[model samples]
Target: MTEDTSWVGPAMQQRVPWVKAVGITFGDVTARRVVAHLPDDPQLHNHVGGPHAAMIFGLGETASGAVGLAAFGSVMDRATPLVVSSEIAYHRLARGPLTAVAELTRPAEEVLAELAGGQRPEFTVTVGISDTDARETTRMVVRWTLRPNR
Candidate 1:
């Protein structure tokens, strides 16, 4: 039987306290997308009293990583994920809590097929950070690759 890994998000925060320190909250996880939030708080506030840019980046990365794991966990059993590359675009300022949602640009099945074929697959995931009003404040694309665990 396969072990349930639904606790991945919270467990990761527990294992890496820094993530929790930045006020990252793990949310919905599915084969389609992964969601996380950066709550509004002093710890994550910037000079203008908005979420720090670094915090936004961190939240986006975390959300993308979760989506990758959810989509390719089995194929990654013998490998580990690495952030090969990433790009972020800041659209506007976030004045309150922000939500980050990440999902693959392509179909999960196609990416999995490449992995199943013994090819090291790389997928691009797009994360959109939105404010409490659901307006996009930041957008990021994270390219992930799996490398054999040594």
Candidate 2:
């Protein structure tokens, strides 16, 4: 299967403007990169006037999901794809525009290819989100078990 052009990074950014409204976007993909951000927002504060953890999670989740979805199209049938699991960790408080970047470091893609050959295989994609200052506020590892059908 070929990649799903519709879910490309730019399109997702445009469609899901809400995320962009919150100031989160995808970063470098050829290799590991950090999430870039501006100063923190006081509006989304958690009493302490600092960025809320939920906001951080929201940013990380959407970014991770996009990477997985894009990769799914890259490897599987774009018609019907599979939904998998995602794991993430909050390393610190975020107070700026963030960058979420991901990479399929392992040979799991090979496993996914094998599984896609039969009953649809489950695979994982590791994603990381950090601030532009080179500080990492979140680390995530998302698994997407995909197939042509379900």
Candidate 3:
């Protein structure tokens, strides 16, 4: 069955104002993965003129959220997805426009099955931030939880 992922865009737009403030733009979005881009703007640069660390991190996080919403959106009525934790590492200096690719680390069906059995389910999304040249500059793993509504 095709997944109704039409909610991804509006979810990102309405839920995360901070991402918009940073000028992050989303690309391909699916149940398993998401891609986003951040333009290299002087206002977003760090002292060394690269995208600031926080802006890069936000780009990755937003990509992860887009995929998460695509994967678990059907269950929104019974559960609310929340980011439980995240770990990120900056690997190199990022320059020019940057891209972030995020993918779900666990099968959506598996997580949904656990939730159906009356347990909160947690899953991870891994994101890679790369420069215009396609060299990875940061890596992030964000853990998300689908908490059952009380």
Scored by lDDT, model 2 comes in at 0.57
Model 3: weakest 10-residue lDDT segment is: 2-11
For all candidates, what are the clash counts? Answer: 0, 5, 0
**What digit string (tens of lDDT, one per residue) describes model 1 on residues 88-135?**
999998879889999888887887777667777788999999998999
**For this target, which candidate reaches the highest TM-score against the unseen true structure?**
3
Instruction: Write model 3 residue lDDT over 23-123, tens digit each, in one string.
Output: 77778888999988988889999999899998988898899989988998889899998999999999999999999999999899999999999999999
TM-score of each: 0.87, 0.66, 0.94
Candidate 3 global TM-score:
0.94
| Candidate 1 off by > 4 Å | 1-5
Backbone clash pairs for candidate 3 read none
> Relative to the true structure, how large is the alpha-carbon lDDT of every model?
0.83, 0.57, 0.90
Local error of candidate 3 at 52, Å? 0.6
Q: Flag regions of model 3 displaced more than 4 Å.
A: none
Model 3 lDDT, residue 139, Cα? 98
* Cα-lDDT of candidate 3: 0.90
